[model samples]
Target chain A: MDAGVIPISNTQLALSVILVLITGVISAALRLELLKPLLWGTVRTYLQLTLIGYALTYIFNINNLILIIVIISLMCLVASRTAVRGSPRAGRYSMLLGFFSLWTSTFLVGTIVMVLIISPEPWYSARIAIPIFGMILGNSMNGIALSLERLFSEVKSKISEIEALLSFGASPWESVRDCVKEALRAGMTPTINSLMVVGLVSLPGMMTGQILAGADPQQASRPLPVVVMLMIAAAVAIGCLMLVLLYYKKLFTKEDAIAHYV
Target chain B: MPEFFKFDQIEYHMGAAGRTVKVSSDLEEGSILVIKGPSGAGKTTLLRILARLLECDKGQVFLQGQNWLSFTPQLWRSKINYLAQKPAVFNGTVLDNLKKPFALKIKKDMFNLDEAIDGLRELSLNENLIHQDARTLSGGETARITLLRPILFKPNILLLDEPFASLDDNSARSVMEFLKRWLENETGRGIVMVTHNDIYKDISGIKIQELELSEPGVN
Candidate 1:
């Protein structure tokens, strides 16, 4: 197979460990105490990526749809757990809400990118599907976490204001409308900021990776980063919207009063 | 026939220990019901329950011969409003805060600038305050704005929790006078207030009854 990408040998890969040592040296000089974690992180990154590389090779060759789906679902599950864990104030049902939001958004956005845009063989190719879904999930996980954390904290802090709105005949949705808007804005800001600076202030990882793999700069810049960024934005928006709508109810009682615990 | 605004045997758990407080009372039209209780006696909780802002363990409220369940919570709250002890100032100008209630779908009334300016005057606030940022208002100004918000909405009953807690004596007197005038202005309106201040004693020509809440954890 005449793949344009040049493979890095084991020796060349081993040489990259020196870059981490440079970080370790800085940590030691500054007495930052991050050396141990940095070394451990380096080892884990090497091991995890190597293992995933082998797994991807096998999965890509096998091309089993069920395996691809299970893998995507597992990624979503881990993403949801990580997102919820970042938000300490998230309520008991937050895990469930996080998982549902991530899965739905990733699935919706991933399917659109795959079927409509990429249209890989058999329409569920593991090579394209996994990476795209993983990218969307990673970004949306941060967005959902930020949105949920903001929503919970904002609602708690603004309880009196929310109750005041309720007393003025506002519905539960109406009462927390401002809080929701703030949370949504918090969730969307990072992605929108990145959109503003893409290619100018920063070369995004996807575009850089494609260029490194010997794809034409113009071709790589045109569809890959643009589509991925848009997909991420959509996923983040949908995920935050779904999560907040589902979780805002937890801040209010069935009788439409602010929940005592909140 | 049911008396004008009545709550029967309202039960709520108070404090971390979850002690229950039972409250029951009624208010006549164009009258005032003063809730007297020491600190931690659950006076505010009782008012919140009446406003449907807190779910009572067991109780029923009837407004104008209709059970509270007969009305939606929004409609019930619109008719029976609760003013918190600490005023909630939204992020906007004072006029925007005053006009907030009218923006709700439940309130069909348009905001009256004349009435709002008049309310500011009655509370002894500068009329120009309406253009100021609500967050910049003094404590006394915030309290009066919060009080004026529901008054403009014209609820059937006003459940006030320490409405004069932040006001000076003169301002409190002006607020009391405004509330007295407000109670007398409509046929169906009434007030259920909790205040340690003695200004209610000066409110003449209005029937004033008192409901003293027993201390929490006391049988």
Candidate 2:
């Protein structure tokens, strides 16, 4: 039987609209005011994913290194800007610094994984590089945003305690050490928790996708371990870099005093 | 003239409006600068500006013939300390709180445990309290410990905002006596204590600077 993989035609895909329609109906029945957003989100998701599918197909066919680099850079820029939105009080340079952190960590971790473990032909092949970079960048962006938001909010709420420490002649770093530790922990906890129940509790997106594409189950799950490891490395790198930069940029002034937001 | 710590036409913005308060004074060695006002007269703001926690909108602060603006925050901070009204206690024992200041790179002096205990004794806190958790202490005890911990560094200037508000009459009096003796003995050490109450009225030799809210709308 050809039941190992089930392909969906345009008719089956069109039938998926019923699922979204059901959600919109429920929202209207409940007076949740979510019907508008639900409809818009459904439309956008369909259109965007379709566009991305076409774009990916073209990029993969061309296999030009320059186009891949441009796409990757655009991904980093978008991810960094999204991360910076959570830290509104962060300085003007935050977008630039955020880009640097996201790019460096994702690139470094992604390159090492692709070079050593995956070892795909033409090493920087778009098929392998783009997806791997996407996963690393996406996870690290969340971590960076969470860490920055936590650090800034903690400093604001605990300004008096920070000042108390400063009054004792403690440096800016010493004053905010506790908050920094807490923020870093918060950033890494989600990634670590996912690692705890990878295959047992959930199939995970990458492995599920591979299996759905008709890859052998054993082969499908092979890269999941490396993906998780790369996630941790990228997340830690981004979180640490964000903390260091945020401490220098948002937490302190030119005179090394606590910034006005704090 | 430069030997005295000077606040030259210092102005701090209280809000978006034209609401601003100005304070110009010179704090000489061994002098007590008592900033007197009701609850919302920008008294804490004045002390914060002095502590370098709040930057003033105008003017400059000079200490010992040098512009404090030119000094590093570490240098300015080590010389001038600010005590909050409610006081802040970290998650640790009293001894741990007292030892933290010694960890600062600028504070190279050894942690003087005996001196800390004796100072706490002056504030009616027993030496045994040093081992107890700081967060579990009462309001008065926390205030005393907060005051005691920073003085161990022997900062040149103490910017105290309602240091005695949390204490009762007797405790406040005892604390005042201890502070008086400490100030009299230490020639260059000075204090700027702000209070809504006149509890410190009996203490002599303090230069009173009464503040009035510039904006009628301010709370």
Q: Model 2 misses residue B182 by how many Å?
A: 1.3
Clashes of each: 0, 0
Off by over 4 Å in 2: A1-5, A21-33, A91-93, A223-228, A243-248, B204-219
TM-score of chain A of 1: 0.89
lDDT of each: 0.89, 0.78
- What TM-score, over all chains together, does every model reach? 0.92, 0.90
- Candidate 1 lDDT over residue span A1-262, tens digit each: 2386779899998899999999999999999999999999999999989899999999999999999999999999999998999665545589999999999999999999999998988899998998999999999999998998889888889988888899988999999999999999999999999999998998878998888888889988987788899999999999999999988988778889987677
lDDT of 1 at B118: 88
| Error in Å for residue A163 of model 2 | 1.3
Best by DockQ: 1
DockQ of all models, two decimals each: 0.81, 0.68
Model 2, span A175-215: residue lDDT tens:
88888877787677777777777778887778887788788
Over B1-219, each residue of candidate 2 has an lDDT whose tens digit, in order, gives 456677778887765565677767777777777777655668888898888877887888888888987878888888888888877777789998888778778876588888998898888888999999988999888888888876888888888888888889888877877777777776678888886556667777654444444444332
What's the CA RMSD of model 2 in angstroms?
3.3
Under the 3 Å rule for N, CA and C atoms, how many clashes does model 1 have?
Answer: 0
